[model samples]
Target: MTNRTMTRRDFGSKVITVSAAAAAASLAAPAVLGAAKARVVVIGGGAGGGTVARYVAKGSDDIAVTLINDSPTYSTCFFSNLYLGGFRSFESISHSYDTLAADYGIEVVIDRAAGLDGNGRTVTLANGDTLNYDKAVVAPGIDFKFDAIEGYGPDAVETMPHAWQAGAQAKNLKRQLLDMEDGGTFVICPPPNPFRCPPGPYERISMVAHYFKSYKPHSKIVVLDAKNKFSKQKLFEDGWARHFPDMIEWLPLDITGGVKAVDVASNTIITDDEKFQASVANVVPPQKAGQIAQDAGLADESGWCPIVPETLASLQVPNVHLVGDAIIPGDMPKSGFSANSQAKVCAQAILAELASKQAFKPRFRNTCWSLITTDDSIKVGANYEATEEKIAKIEGFVSQADESDEVRAQTAAEARAWYDAITADIFG
Candidate 1:
């Protein structure tokens, strides 16, 4: 097996000979191994769905996994702020599903899920196809609450792109940012509690301010935050003072009364106490679990679906697991990293259930990175433990507020490395 002992021709001949032998064995043993594998239907092909599909398919020879999604490609919401700030391209964040299907032997269906028949244990696609499964995993992410803000709805997203989901909206927001003149104001309205990525809006402001500091030096970014305090507040504020100075300003809920209305035509956003006009406005509205989850009766009055922590199975039903932003795992922030980690736990729990073994205790981890400037970055991360009722925080975690310059820089590097590694784990 020494590398110097084999020539290219000999290697090629040996590969062909091995392939022929395997083919002959498969053909001869047809009756012994021709049974169809057990089917696992996964809905939504974002971080959670893709990871579970790949892991389950690769983990077992008796399981066949099918992933259903609305789009062929997915764009990362995590790094999209960089694109909006003109630091990265769309292709850098976009990923395809081909690798999951081809390399892992998972069947990826590019179609929307119209509904779920929980009782029948089947998922109905938009095209009227029904897929039955022994177990189903749903990770449909977040859905916007159009009526949460007066005079704001789906139609308004065209001009005031939330840019939260990262796709066309992200591109549109970037265009608006570029179209603005120097010294112009950019207004960003962050949603209330329990939204996807708690620190996302602050990070966005930091990144956008980074852009303004370099190009439109006189420009200002005003954050109309609905919450009194946000994730990584002290770190973000320190970063702003050290980096952007007066370029970025934040108005808490009490000061701004929260963004109540937007006059799209005049490019003005009205809060309860004041009215502000801007060259560009980014309004991230209140959110709920994706529509599919709501339609399946998985969501409660609070707009989030509750699940049993250890199994991630819906509290309302059995055998249906909910992961990612869709599930209300207590104390867990809704982020892609959270989703990916939870999906693995769900997969292991499902395998245990199938084998009639005690389900493994679930542990989770999440790390979120924000680019403060071209050079500096901030991050918050934690580990979680699951009980019968809720997912609680465990030890071995760090926050940006606790980091020194060297630690922050090291974390920034880890952030980029993590992005590459996780995307590879999802798509590759």
Candidate 2:
């Protein structure tokens, strides 16, 4: 991996028809009659919640907005893989909430949202304080299903290093790779479909392979996937064959015999058919909506929140909305771009619902980039529109198999540009 790119984390034009910040004059709520301005409380300051807080606050002078996050600073999961692959530093992917608070007039609360009283229209923080809200946007993102993988739970992360959450664990995974012997084997177990970043594990393999090839040539990598096929399957197969033949091996679900369990002490992943020993084991367990979403009673039996496509309003609870990997958004892969896009639409819907402004049609978009080797990247993306039923895919595109080196380099550049732009759009 090389020291590479940065830009906006999203692509395509955003069509917004929002009124001026003074649109709340037409608000039909009790706040319009000499009450405190309507309060909007956003939980989880990621691409989705942060953007919503900014957009809603930026759109209305009559809404007092507050963003609640567990952390003081936000670290993006989008480019954390680049950090693992040695392309970017840890600091590059981390962002602050100063701008979201100071510039957008949003009160950024550095505390976890422990409970939500939808009936009372209030969010209870872990700090024992309750904040009332006219509307609440819940974007707690994905939390790992540690119980899904036997012998690999929260206690085992320090050893096996799932690194899926992309913070200290990412640093831990990187350190493990650096400390391994020259010919040591690294094993990765990807979760089942509908997980965040469908192509993430494969890209991790690519980046890790790049690191091993450059520093430890004889090292080996094995992928024990939970699914039979994966996103960008052919493209990744082609890139692996071209760039690191004999260095990596991928066994699909039927062939890999589905992950049965693991032995964290021995760095071994036990399967239905065999056991894989490795110097490093990256076991990304299955995931579900963050705890707050589940605790708020917003999630269904699927452990994910269901939302109305147009407004992103929760189907389970009124005056509550969901976004990012927490929502079962139709036809949209869980990505930062998708979250950012959904937040924009969600903010508009909230604005309209809160202040009686006309809302625009909801459109969503997502593009995912993976680096195979130095200066070589593959991308897949799609455009979507919201119908009464779901968010339907309008069209899509992916990187071709037999592209030129110049074109691949250009694709890598495009990914870098997206990184720079999306981070700014989400953080600033």
Could you say which candidate leads in lDDT? Answer: 2
In model 1, the Cα lDDT at residue 343 comes to: 86
**Cα lDDT of model 2 by residue, 1-428, tens digit:** 11111111211011122244544445446345434466688999999998888889888877777888888878888888889889999999999888887788788888888899998777877777777777899999998887887898789899898887778889999999999999999999999977999999999999999999899999999999999999999999899998888999898889978888989778889998799998999988898999999999999998999899999999999889888989998999998899999999999998887755578888899999999988999999999998888888999999999899999999999999999998888877
The digit string of per-residue lDDT tens for model 1 on 61-142 reads 6665778888888998988988877777899999988788778877787888899888876788887777766578988999
lDDT of 1 at 310: 80
Clashing pairs in 2: 6-420, 7-419, 7-420, 7-421, 8-418, 8-420, 8-421, 8-422, 9-421, 9-422
How high is the CA lDDT of each candidate model? 0.81, 0.85
Lowest-sum lDDT 10-residue window in model 2: 3-12
